[model samples]
Target: MILSKRSLLATATAFALVLPAGWAIAKEQLDVVATTGMIGDAAREVGGDLVKVRALMGPGVDPHAYRQTRSDIVGMAKADLVLWHGLYLEAQMEDFLNELSESGNVVAVAESLPRNLLIGHEDYEGKFDPHVWMNPNLWSRVVLNVRDALIEVQPESEATFRANADAHLEELRELARYTTEVLSSVPAESRVLISAHDAFNYFGNAYGFEVMGIQGISTESEAGLQRIAEMVDTIVRRDIRAVFVESSVSDRNIRALIEGAAAEGHEVTIGGTLFSDAMGAAGTYEGTYLGMIDHNATVISRALGGDAPERGMSELLN
Candidate 1:
């Protein structure tokens, strides 16, 4: 019996399917690129095995100062869908993203957030804060927006994406609750959070802390001596316990704050390293979006005279 081309193709396909799952691979796959690791995490949750997600900024990378390398440009050009956190968080990449928007299905996930909830940029004045994801409650909204975006791109997988997004959103809600409960432990008097940069305004606003910063919203801005003196005096007079250093930003400013306080006969120490501007490494618990916030909540609560456990939210049983 002679086999025709169609009959041979059908037999080969049947054999391929019966072999193994990993052996049957497609030559082309969905291309997805997100600006930050946090956005990548959300996209991965929603996309699952159906899509590929790429983050422009990785662990310990400062988004504010990040410039698109030649490889990043190529990646963006090749992406089927690109998502970025708008609101000026990626100042350096703003122009690149704008240009990429004209060429492909590029989305600014944070743009869907309500204007009222966002804090305006200090120097830019009218611009809203780009760090909306700092608040877990606000972050949940972004996750939902991400689900919708992914559904729009791949309608066939809508059910899968929605379920994943729903599961992730539940985790985010739990994160918000945990954040509030943990922060509640900090005494009212010691509920001040002074960090190296002004990235945690939304966090403070959400959790009832008076947030102060040595530097402005943009890490590119300098912390003048006057600013340092003012914070030092505030710490000394107010008897503030500690300040925090971010993983992306240099600890130079925080070290200055500590030394200034020491010169004035007051002791100040860095409470702990905070995951700001980026998440921790992949595979580590601290690397996940939920873990990132959990770490921040635990650090801030303990540093500010609150009763917090070393292992983070009791959910982890630590």
Candidate 2:
């Protein structure tokens, strides 16, 4: 049954009170519920064996439009810590998450990023772009925030969390290096990235590529015929070769761009699908946060006449 917010908060309070009694004499693993797979991955990496993380949104799920299910509400209520990418990334869940924070250990990891570093959200006043994961270097800051959250929830395990976070941060540094190197291989004029939406703004900003999107930052923003026609004109005039589709977003508009370009006697191909707003399948390497960015960098670089390995930075992308 769909529980009202009041009932859900009451249920959470009940769970919080009784949960301690069920713990063994030994400490139990900290239970973490993150809003997206990216946040969950950070928790798992930082918390290591000390925490059990569950991501509410999985592969191909659009956080922009996702609403919590009854099961999700129950899980978050029981969780010891809840992490969500703030900055309106979880647009639909913002109010619920804010309300949930009143009683639980809830943290908006991405919101921890400094304002000066963030791109302002065009549609929403005072809100920053939520897609910080696009730039691994910037994401490193979020990883630190995750580490701090885990430590706050369970201070005794700070050593483990610190070590794990350090290792993960190193990996992220390497990912940033690799992406910068490969993405740099594209000629300046060919470095334009056109996608289903404006999810890659950070990536563009980080790597010096111009980005175009048929839809706005949120996929919920509609792409009109005029926008599509404008993009088509841009592509043809610029002699752009490839445009990308996102895993979580519909490709209808991208296809429209291609058709429009073709009608103008200019061919535009679909660059490999990018994992925007989500990662790959659960079991694959691409499902991991590192692999997700690696795949995007490799795909974008290769499609835009740059050099990147077929398998990606770690040779683990699938």
> TM-score per candidate, in order?
0.90, 0.93
Question: Which residue runs does candidate 2 get wrong by more than 4 Å?
Answer: 1-6, 10-27, 316-318
Q: Which residue pairs clash within candidate 1?
A: none
Residues 252-290 of candidate 2: C-alpha lDDT, one tens digit per residue: 999999999999999999989999999999889899999
The weakest ten consecutive residues by lDDT in model 1 span 17-26
**Residue 242 of candidate 2: its Cα lDDT?**
99
Which candidate comes out best when scored by TM-score?
2
Residue 249 Cα positional deviation in candidate 1, in Å, after optimal superposition: 0.4
Runs in model 1 deviating more than 4 A are 1-29, 314-318
After TM-score superposition, the amount by which residue 172's alpha carbon in candidate 1 deviates from its true location, in angstroms, is: 0.7
| TM-score of candidate 1 to 2 decimals | 0.90
